[model samples]
Target: MTFSIVARSADGRLHGVAVASKFLAAGALVPAAEAEVGAVATQAHVNLAYRSQGLALLRTGVAPADVVAGLTAADPGRDERQLGVVGSTGDGATWTGSFCHPWAGGQAGDGWAAQGNILVGPQVIDAMRDAWLDGSELPFPQRLLTALRAGDRAGGDRRGRQSAGLLVVRRRGGYAGTGDELVDLRVDDHPDPVTELGRLLDTHTMLFGKPDPATLYDLTGPLADEVAALLAAAGHPVGVAGLDGALASWAGVENLEERIVAGRLDPIVLEHLRRTAPPGRTGD
Candidate 1:
C-alpha cells in the first residue's frame, strides 16, 4: 500500500522520511521525525501509536530495532504491520508482518530502510534503495524523494498514488535565522502530490533561505562609488535613496550566493557588489 525511506543525514544533524501511498493521505499516518533524534515510517496495517512512541524511544536513546520491537509488542495487529526505522547513528531497521497483503516485504541497510506491501513485487523496495544509493550527492530530502520517485516508477502503491509527504529537520531552521524546524512540507491529497511538494519546497526556499556564508557580500572599497553604480544599474534613478535603499540594493539581483550558483544572477556582479556594498539594515 506504501513505500517509505527513513534516514539520518551524513552530517548527523538531520533526520527525515519520504513516503507515498494509495491509502488516502499517507502523510497523516506515515512518516514522523524529530531533529537530531531519528525517523520512522509505519504502514501496512499501521499502528498509529508508533509515531509518537517511536520518537519518544529514540529520544530516550533507544535503538532502532528496540523501538520496532517495543512498538510491535504493544500492538495486537503486529502480524499485519510493515514498518521502517532509522536511528540517529544511521542504524536502519524494518519489519513486514507475516499477514500483510500480497507482494509484501522489505529491505534495510546502513542509512536507510525501504518497505512496501501489496502489488508490484519486491522491485518497488529495491528500486527505492538503489535510487537513494545512486543519489547520495543530493540533499537528504532530495535523496528521499528520488527514492520515492524510483519506487513510483517501478510500479508503486499496489493500489495507486493518492498522497505524498516529506519531513526533514535540523538543529536550526537553516535559514530565516532561527532555531526552529528546517523543512516541514506535506501534500495531504492530490492526484500528483509529489510534484506539488517539490513546488512548495522551492517556494519555501526562496522566502526563508538565508544567503550562504560563501555567498555573503563583503566590501573592500569606497562605499560612495559602489552605492552610486548599484543605484544607477537598479534604475533606482534616485541616488543612494537612503540606508534602507542601500541595504536593499546590496541584496540585489546577484548579491545572494545561491542565486549566483543557480545561474539566476551573474556571479561576477555579485562578487563586485560584495567587495563594495555598504553596511546597513534591510527588510522585506
Candidate 2:
C-alpha cells in the first residue's frame, strides 16, 4: 500500500520523512516529526497515535526501538501495523507486523529507516536504502525524496501512485525562523506525485533557502560595482548602504536572509536576480 523513509541528517540538525502511497493524502497521516526529538512513519494498519505518541516518547529521551516497542505494545492492532523511527542522535528502528501484506518488511540502520507494504519485492526497500546511502551530497529533504524515487523506480506501490508527502524538521527552519516544520510538501493526488513534489521543492528552495558559506560571493571592488549597477537596473537604490538595504529587503521578502551577511552578498542571490529579473537583463 505504501513505502516510506524516515531519517535524521548526518549532522543531526534535521529529521524528516518521505512517503508515497496508493491512497489519497498519505502525507497527512503517514509522516510525523519534531525539531530536536525524532521522526516516525506509521503505516500498514496506520496507527494515528504513533505520530504524536512517538514524538512524545522520543522527547522523553527514549531510544527509537523502545519507542516502537511501547507504541506497539499498547495497540492491539500492532500485528497489522508498520512503524519506523529515527532519533535526534541519528539512531533508528523499524517494525513490520506479521499481518502486513506480502513483500512487507523493513530495514533500519544508523540514521535512517525504510519500510513498505503490499508492493514490490525486497528490492524496493533495498533501493531506498541504497539511494539514501548514495545521496550524502544532497540536502536531507532532497536525499529522502531521492530515496523515495528509487523505491518508485523499483516498483513502489503495487496498487499504483496517487499521493505523496514529505515532512522535514530543522532547528528554527520554518517560515520566518518561527517553528521547525522546514519542508512540509505534499501531493495529495497526482499522476506522478514524486515529480510533482520535486517541482514544489524547487519553488520552496528559491524562496526559503540560504546560500552556503562555501558558495558565498563577497561584495567588494568591481564586483560590487556590477551588483550595484544590476540593482539599479532592477529599480533598487544604487548607493552602497541603499543597495545593501534593498537587497536585505528582497531577501527578507523571500525569507532567505539566513545566507546573507549584512555587508556582503551571496552569489546564489545574484544568480537568482540574474535569472528571474527580465528577458533583456544579463549579469555576471
Candidate 3:
C-alpha cells in the first residue's frame, strides 16, 4: 500500500527518500537516509530495522544490491517485506517480496530506485522512474518529490493515500549547518498528503534555504525604506541605519533568522514580510 523513491545526488553528497502510503504515519517508518551514505524505503510488511540497518550497511561501502540481499537474507519474514536502496555510488536496488499484495514490484538504475506494493498498477513505479530520470537537473529534494508526484498522478497506492514524507540529507546541510537533515518533512495524515508535502517543502525552502548571493539586495534607497516601514508596522520600529539589528530581531521572532544576511536581504524574506505586513499597512 505504498510507493517510494530512494536516490543519491549526482555528486554523491546528497541522499534522500520520498514515500506515500495508505498506512497511518508511514513517514515515521518507511523512509531513512544518511548524508554521504545512502537511502532506504521499507514497506509492505514494513521491517523498521531495514532503515537503520540499511544505512549502517551503506556506511560500510556495501553495494546497494548487496545491502538488499544481506538485509532480506537475515529476515525470516523476508517474503512479506519490500525494500529499496541506493548507495553513495553505483547502481541502486529494489526488491518486492513474494507475499506482498498483487501489483507490486520495483525498478532501479545508476542512482535511484522506485518501488511500490499493492499499487494501482505497474504504471506507478514506471512513472516514478521516468520522472526521476527526467529530473536529473532539479534540486535533489525537488527531484525526489517530483518523482513521487508523478507516481501519485499515475495511480498510486491501490488502497489510497494517508501519509507522505520527504527526507534529504547532506553533509552539514541542516539548519545553520548544525545537522545533516537538509529537508525532513512529513504529512502524517492528510486528504491530499503529497500536495501538502509540496507546500511544506516550499515553506521549508523559504525559511531555511540559504541566500543566493546574486539575489541579495543591499539595504538602500526604496528597498530600505520599505523594509523599515514593514518592520515598524510589525511593531519592531527601525531607522535605516538600524535596519540590520532590528531586522534580525524581527526575523528571530518570526522564525526566519536562518534567512537573514548581515547587511542584505533575501527576496524570500522580503516577500514574507510583505505577506505578513498587516494587510493594508503593506503599502502594496
Query: Which prediction has the highest TM-score against the true structure?
Result: 3
Which of the two, 1 or 2, has more lDDT? 2
Number of clashing residue pairs, candidate 1: 0
Question: In model 1, what is the error at residue 228, expressed in angstroms?
Answer: 9.7
Model 3 RMSD vs true structure = 1.6
| CA lDDT of every candidate | 0.75, 0.88, 0.93
Q: List TM-scores for all candidates, in order.
A: 0.77, 0.88, 0.96
Stretches of candidate 1 exceeding 4 Å from the true structure = 174-180, 216-284
For candidate 2, the lDDT comes to 0.88
- Candidate 3 displacement at residue 80 in angstroms: 0.4
Cα lDDT tens digits for candidate 3, 1-284 = 89999999999999999999998988899999999999999999999999999999999999999999999999999999999999999999999999999899999999999999999999999999999999989989999999999999998998888999999999999988999999999999998999999999988987888889999999889998899889888878785649998899899998899989998999988988988877667444
- For residue 12, what is the lDDT in candidate 1? 75
- Report the lDDT of model 2 for residue 214: 74
TM-score of 3: 0.96
Model 3: lDDT of residue 118: 91
Consecutive 10-residue window with the lowest summed lDDT within model 2: 275-284
